[model samples]
Target: MTTTPRFKSDAFEAIHSAASGLHRSGVVGKQTMREFDALCLAEAPHFDAKSIAAIRKAAKVSQPVFAKYLNTSTSTVQKWESGAKQPSGIAARLLQVVKKHGLDVLV
Candidate 1:
């Protein structure tokens, strides 16, 4: 019989404990866990076109301003926000970063 060794048992336990703390504190819940799983498994944001447009609208910025902040073109922003086109590659990455960090890079 052959035995295989698993790695970093202590580190895994520590991470699990931290996640449990987050769950206990209500910082993480079933919905959050599901979303996290989707993000990890699908490698994409959960937002759809309408949701992206709504987020842009809620940000209260014009397409040009939003595009500038995203380091993309105004036309591309219009396409994305209007659901005519989807952001991809670096554009998608920039959008994700901006969603998390706001327009801090613009300043």
Candidate 2:
């Protein structure tokens, strides 16, 4: 993330910061902090097979290596690239991060 995340507004950032402080001070529980974290996170955008392949290529990694970073199987990556299936949930979100911040961030 940057100084201010693109996903959240200034108000959300302020609230999140306060929630983070509360979390650190043990004033807020992990569950509440997790809710705050979810509010701050952007929903993963849908990517077509071409876009998925391009992102992988741009990272300069093979399917197996990319799969390793994403904690998924190489065949899953292949399925995504071939339009046989699509990435969802965590994998999709990780792809968004890789697309925006580069694959190095995940490492």
Cα deviation of 98, candidate 2, in Å: 0.1
Query: In lDDT terms, which candidate is top?
Result: 2
Q: Across residues 29-99, which tens digit of lDDT does each residue of candidate 2 receive?
A: 99998899899855657988999999999999999999999999999999999999988877887999999
TM-score of 1: 0.50
lDDT of 1 at 95: 66
lDDT of 1 by residue, 1-107 (tens): 66332224566545555665788899999787555444333243444577667667766888787777777788877777667888775577566766776667456
Q: Please report, as a residue range, the 10-residue window in candidate 2 with the lowest summed lDDT.
A: 1-10
Candidate 2 to truth, TM: 0.61
Model 1 stretches astray by more than 4 angstroms: 1-47
RMSD of 2: 6.8
